[model samples]
Target: MYTKKNYTIKRMLSWTRRYIFMFILLSTIPVVLYEVLDWKWLHLPWLPIGLVGTALAFIIGFKNNASYGRLWEARKIYGGIVNASRLLATMVNDFITNEYALKDRTDAEFFEIKKSMIMRHVAWMTALRHTLRVKKPWETTTNNKSDQEVMKKLHIQEYAFTLEEELKDYLSKEEKQAVLSKTNKQTAVLNLQSKAIKELKLDGLIDDFRHVEFKNMIGELFTLQGKAERIKNFPYPRQFATLNLFFAWIFVALLPFGLMSEFEKIGETLNGSNHTGILFQFISENFVWLTIPFSVVISWIFFTMERIGDVSENPFEGIANDVPITTISRGIEIDIREMIGDDKNEIPKPHPEYEHTQM
Candidate 1:
């Protein structure tokens, strides 16, 4: 997600330049036809266009609100994951102990077990993020040329490496193969975690109570993962998205025509006034031409609002404004590794930001 407080005007304009040009073209055509070609009859009524604008405003507002809800929910789910991961690390360190062991292992052996469980949890997170990053049919943000350009500008860690490559560092060859063989790799990893905790219980590293607690924690992680998947799998309603776009464009197309007549009337009034200065008179005589910029600005606002909802609808799509799952996952890994006293050199660093955007 964008780390800065706001996007620079230059970047915003650059991202929407093509659409701005289209808005200008859409605005200019009606003005040219009405004023230059004497097609005065082509102008639309102000009341009808105003009603459309009002309705369009409500539609855009609703869509943006819904999209923001989805984005925030996804972020919250990851926030839960972060907390659960840290808790798991704490539990692994404190719960698994020689106090109840049938056969005690050395401190180094215990540390290795803790490290293995923690690293496997990290691998689970890696798999989850990779699964979310996989493009869905409804996720068309990357398909746009302008959006593709924006994506290239940011450094998305998930795109830089494959899940298999990342898993190598955290999982044993056997465990990695087992997890990778499943269609739902994250689920497989979590199942492995559950089995390990059960074995610890059976082997007396942890008692029945601690084992139950571990199971509950694993269940919570599974719940969080399911929430994230729900948002990723089921998109904002397509009918709403499609109709919103159509209505916004329809209003944009008719706006210039409606403004033409109103501006012309103002110009006529200026020309008829006896006390007006030359500048006012000149402006009045050519006031209808001002419709071009006004129309462009108004249309740009609607288009930009619509675009915001579109991008926000899928927060996992690796767009510049999306939730930074990759960064968050890496952070969880770092925090938990530190919790277990793993060597700093062994723990991977946090993912880097690019152009003030993290993904």
Candidate 2:
């Protein structure tokens, strides 16, 4: 996700520059008509516009809260995955031993077993993150032209490589084929893990108690996977999202109309005064043009708030503002591999951040 304390105003403007231009154009129309064309009847009352603004603000606030809730929930689910993965690595390192084995093996053999299990778990994480990064019909962050431009600067690891390519490093040829063949690659990888654990139990490398514990941990991983899937599959209520957009645009369209009259009234009041200097009179008489900037700023605020909610609604769309699943998964892989004492060179390094953002 965006790791910086805040986005620079320049960057924000760059991302929304097209819309800002539209707002400027929208604001300038009524001022030109009322001032140059002398169409005084074109201006709207401020009271009704104020009421619409209030209603739009409430809806935007509500949508932001709900969108943040989904993002936070996705983060919590990945946090659980990180903990469970570490626990599984610790269990593999400590529980499987010669003390309980039906047939004793060499130190190299035991190490191989531990390494295989750990690597398989990493493969499962890779499969899961790849699944989450797949596009859903409702996800729009990457579809926007502005968002697409910003994404070019951020390196999203999941999109950089295919699932099969990454899995090759962690899975055997037969296992990788099995995983890729399945419709649900993550579920297939997990099933392979369970089978391997079961075989270890039968060989007495893992005792009965440890076997059950391993099964329980796998179940927890499944639960976490399902939780992430739920958020990925379901979207924030579209009806609310649709209406929120419509309302925000309606308020923006009406804003300048109301503002033109308010500024004109101030200009009229100054024109009637005799005490004001020439400079003050000049400024006051043209004050209605100030409506353009005021309207642009006000419209930009409402539209930006609406855009924030829209982008945040899906946390797994592989955008800069997502939950950083690729980074999290890579971290888990590194931590678990180190725990099992795999070759330092063989263990992959953490995914690097790009433009102060981790994917």
Q: Where in model 2 is the C-alpha error above 4 Å? A: 1-7, 355-359
> Could you give candidate 1's per-residue lDDT for residues 209-312 as a string of tens digits?
99999999999999999999999999999999999999999999999999999999988987888856878877888999999999999998898889888888
lDDT of 2 by residue, 153-201 (tens): 7787778989989988889999999999999998999999999999999
State the number of backbone clashes in model 1.
Answer: 0
Output the worst ten-in-a-row residue range by lDDT, candidate 1. Answer: 350-359
TM-score versus the correct structure, for each prediction? 0.96, 0.96
Residue pairs with clashing backbones, model 1: none
**Which regions of candidate 1 deviate over 4 angstroms?**
1-7, 275-278, 354-359
Cα lDDT computed for each candidate against the true fold? 0.91, 0.89
What would you estimate as the lDDT of candidate 2? 0.89
